[model samples]
Target chain A: MKTCYNCNRLNKDNDRYCRYCGKAIRNNSYYTGLKIGIVLGTLGIIIMLILYAIMYL
Target chain B: MKCIKCGAELEDVDNFCPECGELTAKGHRFFHDPSNLDILNNGKAVKLKKKFNAIISIFSLSVIIFALLMIFTGQNLMTPFGVIQKKINYYRYGYNTSLIKTNNKYNFKVNNYDEAIEFIKKDFSNQLYTCNQNKELTMLEYELESDYEIPSVVFCDMSLEEAHKIKDVIVRMYALFPNIKGNLTNITITNSKTGSDYVAYFQPAYQFVNVNKDIKENNKVNKTQILLNSYYFLNDNILSQDINEVLNNYYVEDATFESTIAHELGHYISFVAFLREKGVSNITLVTKDNEEEIKSLINEFENGEYLKNILEQALNNYNLKYNENLNLQSFAETISKYAGVKDKNGNLLYSETIAEAIHDYYLHNENAKKSSYEIVMVLKSKLKEVF
Candidate 1:
């Protein structure tokens, strides 16, 4: 079960929205997106440095 | 959680206000922790971060490509962005270019050697004229050539007027020893304020002159080009007085600027003769290992006892009435020191003895001692035979 802070209503635990009001549920997408971004950025920089050494040095 | 609209305490399972019927669960979450804001603005934040990452990725890629291009092309990556090509010109031509800074101020270059000569002529026209018109008295012929590896003259701490005076001195030197003009290349003029320790010197050109003809005709590789200094011209009056006082000769047709220039030219002439006698073209090739053999041979002709004795006699006369203030002893020593002895500055003293003897032989003529006169005559005849 979950409680809606806006209206003090009790709702089912699996419900994404309160039974009395409508609001999107918070999820872990933000953390997932940030982790993927950091990994990809690091990989890109490493690849650039390797290519730079081979071609220039 | 508590309801915001009706100040009512609520259990976690509540979805609406029990007293007021206000909905609670459907409202936006009260951001108790700052990290919750990221969840709320997840879509926009992700898009912004991705945009920033793309920008950085693109910039890094561009840098890598630029570095690779520079390495492949053998271009200098550190050269300023616009003048990279000019830097290449300096390596290619081995002559003055706009990229080279003279006196750390002026940047000068020409399309070719001829243009370089013309540039100098145009800048110092009045001085060149003074030298040319007075060639008979100065005994110098102006031969400004741009084909050489360096500028004929580099001036430091000198005005255009003084540069003109130095030009006159060089013109006189060339006129006195016309044969040496071919082997001579450049002259650098610097004043006392600039702190020129060498006072005057001659730097041989490293590259072979007339490379194709030299290899075919002489079977030799490089030839030396003589360079002269202009420090002596900085204080002509004081130097002339000192020379007159040291030599006990009146300021007549003897030791003047002409004598100094002639003395330097004598050094060039002796080197040329030495090269010709050895059947060699490059002096740099004659390293210290073979220098003694070559010097011994050259000295047999240039460093005879007769010339040395006369030089010593002159120095002895000067030292008898030495002036503590004047560098007359050093000046005289430059012209007449014994072979192998170093000066106060640890430089070889008698390197110019033969040159000095030659100058005196020319100045004093029949009045010069028998041995000195004969030696100068032999050098003159040998120069004529070889060159």
Candidate 2:
């Protein structure tokens, strides 16, 4: 079951809002943006490395 | 609970307050001294509280359930936990030691990597550690890291063009471990400048406690340092053929090179484990740490001649009692002598007998644990005569 948004109460997992006091149930998007930035950086570095190796060889 | 912005006890107001306004932390305005909420809330907020309670309960329950699965499956589930749990993750194995799991086939106790690597180096320096030789490890050190990578043995003695068939055989066995890579390279260096033709090396050492295979009739090919300094089978076409033929004479066609490697590797690895299990130390240099004369005396026992005598006697004195399948007269003068049996009549009996017994014990016995004291003292003393 999902939790209600208003109070820290039990609600069905499918429910969008909290069971006690209505609150958004989506886990805090604390690192989603950070993770995406990291992914982009890693891809860029890898591409650069590939180009550098190709040029040297 | 009063609204801090309005200085008013929480009453009919917006999420802020009528007197003054301040944003409230989520659900903080609803806080009250605990009385009977779940029961009252059920009709009141009962269904909502139950639903939310179920969610929180499931999260905690999931953690418990996953922990149970990790325990039963012997798989490390720490990495899969949440951020806080992942930071503090630990696994336990091998005498209550906490271990960290790695995505490598070379899984072992945390403390063993150092011991494993040190032992491998000692094997390299002394040349005493071979896959098949049944030698007592005087001292050992190990460096145990979860490096599942199979090592590459460089063979400077011959190139793949020269040793194609042997290369195929070695690499095929290596392919068994997912991480093992690289083809054999020959790097045999006689002097600093003159490298031998048949040499290769493997990396990220792993331990092989023992490779038990039949040695009689099959020439036992013991390899040292299967972990690193990759194994190289020198191409002596004539000698290889001779070794093959000798092997054929002793056994059936089923006993092929494939079966032989496992057994030869077993001997070296068992000794490696033996030394580590006993916590042996000071293995950097191969030469004796004590008197050179004393070292010589001890070395003779290692040759395995004397213990052969005592065991041969044990079997001879009691063979008729042990088994009734053998012909009596044929037993007295047989090839048992070459198979580590002593020359005396009783010596062959027990020596061959013990080889069979110990071999069986090693292969089938539920507990293959050793008594180092028995090996170092009782067994060593008995072999003093042979040395």
Candidate 3:
């Protein structure tokens, strides 16, 4: 079972919304997107440094 | 779930409290967690993080720009580092003010040639003012009646006795060349201790001395004075012996210390004659007209054979090799033979041929070589007519 944060009512675990008040459930996709962005930015900086060294030195 | 406003307990299915009709769902415990509240309200921490990132970005960009500039230009543009290096160089080789203060006790500055002459006269007039007081003193002054005259002086950095000897030689030289008396106002006598050779040269008063001011609006001429090195006169025993031996090979007899002064005076006289013939005051103004005059004069010299023979003989006697293909048809070539040929791009020096000719004419007279004597006679006649 899962608890509805808005209505204070118990619902089925697989339900996407609260049964009593009809509030939509939130997911972890936003946090996952933010982690991917951080990783790609770091890689881009490292690539720029390598290119700079090759061209100049 | 519980509603804090009414302190009422409710079932999970209920939206509001039973006792006070308060909304129990609005006050959820998950949303009221301390950690979540901290993240939502920390504006200062977020602002600080943004400022730190901006600083890092700017610093990295500047470093990259600096590196690129250095790679492209190959010059050290580091301002602070360059300033430090300049300071080090200045400390190492800059002028020594303390030495000047200790040795140069008779230092004086004058505005013009007249003022410099007055200053020198006044200094000499004083009975107490001896050369012993100052071994190295300079009298700085400017030339008179020119549009452009810089502060020039006759420096004497020698012992009292040596300076006096050079002064006497200068007076004698002035007496010989009355025509150059005005230009010979400034005289410098330097000693051997200065690590310089026994060199005597004339520094012209003006780069362009305009003798014919009425003819041209901006006529220029070369007006010069002699500078004598005191070393040859001061240490005559050792230096004169060496010079005399070298001069003896040319069949030149009795070459005294005074002969050197006369030789320099010869250069001055030749320079004056050159200016008069050209009809222009300044050497810098030597144009096709002057070249033509020089060529005609060279032609008039028995078809250049006389000069060619003399030059060839001199070179052979001295063991100095010259250009075999030298064309005496060219005025520059004729002058170069007498003056000693230099590299192609070098300024054609004041003709040493004419100077030596004049020197020989003045000293040897009837005994002087026929070629040199003739050349001097022609130049002197021309100069007398012009002046």
Instruction: List candidate 2 stretches off by more than 4 Å.
Output: A1-57, B1-253, B262-298, B303-306, B313-387
lDDT of 1: 0.46
Docking class of 3: incorrect
List the lowest-lDDT window of 10 residues for candidate 3 chain B. Answer: B95-104
**Chain B TM-score by candidate, in order shown:** 0.39, 0.27, 0.39
lDDT of 1 by residue, B170-217 (tens): 555455445554444445442333322333444333323222332223
- Can you give the DockQ of every candidate in the order shown? 0.07, 0.03, 0.02
Model 2 agreement with the true structure over B50-146: per-residue lDDT tens digits: 5444555554565566557545644334323222222242121111111111112222222233454443333333321112121121111110111
lDDT of 3 by residue, A13-54 (tens): 665544344444334353344445445545545644544453
**Model 2 in CAPRI terms: which quality?**
incorrect
Give me the TM-scores for chain A across all models, comma-separated.
0.51, 0.44, 0.50
**Residue A30 of model 1: what lDDT?**
51
Model 2 chain A poorest ten-residue lDDT run: A48-57
Model 3 spans with C-alpha error above 4 angstroms: A1-57, B1-130, B133-180, B191-196, B206-223, B240-242, B246-253, B274-350
Each candidate structure's TM-score, on Cα atoms with residue i matched to residue i, is: 0.35, 0.25, 0.36
lDDT of 3 by residue, B282-311 (tens): 332222344344335434442334344434
Per-candidate RMSD, Å? 17.7, 21.9, 20.8
Order of the predicted models by DockQ, top scorer first: 1, 2, 3
- Candidate with maximal DockQ: 1
TM-score of 1: 0.35
lDDT of each: 0.46, 0.32, 0.43
